[model samples]
Target: MIYDQPKFLPGGDRYMLVEFGNEMNLELNFMGQSLAQAVADNDVKGVIETAPCFASTLIHYEPEDISFKDLQSEMASLIGTLGPSEDIELDSRLFYFPTVYCDPWTKEAVDDYRAKIAEKEPDPEFVARLNGLSDVDQFVRVHSGTEYWVASLGFWPGLPFMMALDPRCMLTAPKYNPPRTWTPQGTVGMGGASTCIYPVATPGGYQMFGRTPVPIWDTQKRFPQFENSICLFQPGDRVKFVPCELDVYELVEAQVADGSYQYNVVEYQKFSVRNYKAWVESLDTSARF
Candidate 1:
């Protein structure tokens, strides 16, 4: 179906999905890339934004500005003219992220992850590099995940999507428990080989072994970045998880609360949602904001 013109979604007028394939395979991912590049490279009229994932591209537009039919035809025509994908070379950034992987924060053991080094504390840099996604053109150096790609941004503002992790470096999921509403801001955590930040202090579900200083999000600013980029990571950018000390968190807390800061509430609320959408969304279900 790589050569086939993209099909229109029968039910929707506002948006349509360009599906690459049914299975999550490598070849399909390439095809998806080709399709995304075609649309991005083409000079369409009404497209406001376009986002690419591992195997699909979500194109957003104002239906009134340009009819969906016309957009589809243009995309189809460009697909044929599109060029081969250049390698996805990500920006290279190496930095340290602060973390507090200790007794109460981290469990003693989780199934096969039975290694104890709780004498003083584990290394602050828990990750050497992360890797799972290798679309080449979007993120080629992500072989070891040392370099990460922003795949999908959602669940909170400024929370960028880091591409998937290597099957080997992945740790088992943490024990099931109720998400905390206020996980200390910049909590560093992992879930099913994926690395994420709580962005701010809010309730969370993933195993939060430590914390970070790099603000995951900031809504405190008068205007939100990327309009509505839920994650600090984006669909094609890379991130370096720098570690910090617990004492540093205390200082940041003070700075955030100070009136002189720019996006105190913005960062907190955005990441608060990122901390646990389940909880916040639940509030909506119960008529609570």
Candidate 2:
């Protein structure tokens, strides 16, 4: 739930955690991102950087430059300037990713996890059944029908924690019981209304469904998009997964291997919270793509 006022809490000596709400929703995220931008635009003194999460922003500051009390005061003032969530407009990039749904890689991983750790249903079928979808085909259609918002990056370097932007596509699943020993790189998975793409093979809990050949993180900076940061996504970026066949996935993989693949991106778009709210209001929540 959203708090009546923002809570400013201390994070050690050099960090400040400003929480907008306890629940995970886009409205709270807008407030967090707005405050982060306000800090940068207002040139808040002693602030090193701000990391905005789903419902809060973690502020890194220099104690020698600004005292905790004074920093709180400055941040409070900035929060006041942010106005309301509906009035917020932010620069957001849209990325198109080619994803292979119900892929063999994630299936094999799930099978191995069940054999080694615990016995459970297949990831895709389990999620589909839990969500009341007819089958995996419908599940894939619903999941890929809408764009996902990158709410934050966590757990792994460059790993994105995202939420479905369209209300119709919203789906939830339980994570693995003991957690998988490893997940394939670029695997797309979902848990608790959030979707994520694995940046690298690592221990994971989300129910996996798809795999993308395009790299979301490249330490070598092979692509032009990685010029500024090794991570491909920021908090406000959006992702649209395009379902593809194994042959297409392999083709893109080959292109990526030679550093010849180009990322499909729309960089000039600005996300308007007001417009989004209006669209959501007009939609039938019971409907699915």
Candidate 3:
């Protein structure tokens, strides 16, 4: 289980995706997440963010500041630490809030967005009709309540893809079709034993169950921001979505606005030139950023 020489990445001029391969194996997932945290925890210079996917972890950084070879070396050295017994899971737990998802789109609204790619890929009408995904057996189980982990963070600031789900809850691909574009913000989804929600939606394709008002992103970070500043989910954390009441939702939103609210555990998009610009500007203005 060691990549002795460590896989070096092309790092396209500035960013790099250190691939572990496209295996959703639990071991790979754990390794990828652990390495990411180690890099971030060590505070690697020039490392802006690390995003872990099925089998790869992408690191966003300034190559001009730190050479690829050096970063790779750091990553290789980092693989030495990880797993359930290695660190404190981020105590991910539950925090409930309110969401209003009623296919909000009328036939007219659907037609308007139809030409756009966003309208085409939707949670299959059949899936919605049958409430299909919900019926999948609880695919995973846990010995006890453990906090979730922040596998990696990127895509959107504060938006950290998290971990910790009973296989029972883990979702497989296409028992049903998923929405093309979820609410700009209010989606809770579980992917392969990992449950997460887009703090603020832009465009994604994941199973949706409920919504919450946990403000994971802050738009004020940059003009024309894409729900900027997604409140990131970190590792060694526990998460739970609180079932919210209207009054609670309102109160939570206010708390988020004021920067005082919290969550037990909570946690994509294509982009145009404009989208890219917003992303760059929205980054935290400190460090090698």
Best by TM-score: 2
Worst 10 residues of 2 by lDDT: 79-88
Which number leads on lDDT? 2
| lDDT measured at residue 56 in model 1 versus the true structure, 0 to 100 | 61
Per-residue lDDT tens digits for candidate 3, residues 12-101, read 787877776554544465667667768878999989887776457788888877988898877877775554422333333343334423
User: lDDT, candidate 3, residue 149?
Assistant: 40
Q: What is the C-alpha RMSD of each candidate to the true structure, in Å?
A: 14.4, 2.3, 12.9
Per residue, candidate 2 scores C-alpha lDDT tens digits across 1-289 of 9998899999999999999998777998888878888999988889999988889999999999999999999988888777777777889999999999999999999989888899999989999999999999999999999999999888899999998999999999988788888999999999888899999999999999999999999899999999999999888899999999999999999999999999999999999999999999999999977
Please tell me which model should have the higher TM-score, number 2 or number 3: 2
Q: After superposition, how far is residue 53 of candidate 2 from its true place, in Å?
A: 1.2
lDDT tens digits, residue span 45-94, model 1: 78877655555666777788888788777666765565443333333222
lDDT over C-alpha atoms for residue 149 of model 2: 96
Q: Which ten-residue region of model 1 has the weakest summed lDDT?
A: 264-273
Backbone steric clashes in candidate 3, count = 54
Q: Which candidate model has the greater TM-score, 1 or 2?
A: 2
Give residue 59's error in model 1 in angstroms: 1.9
The per-model lDDT (C-alpha) reads 0.46, 0.92, 0.50
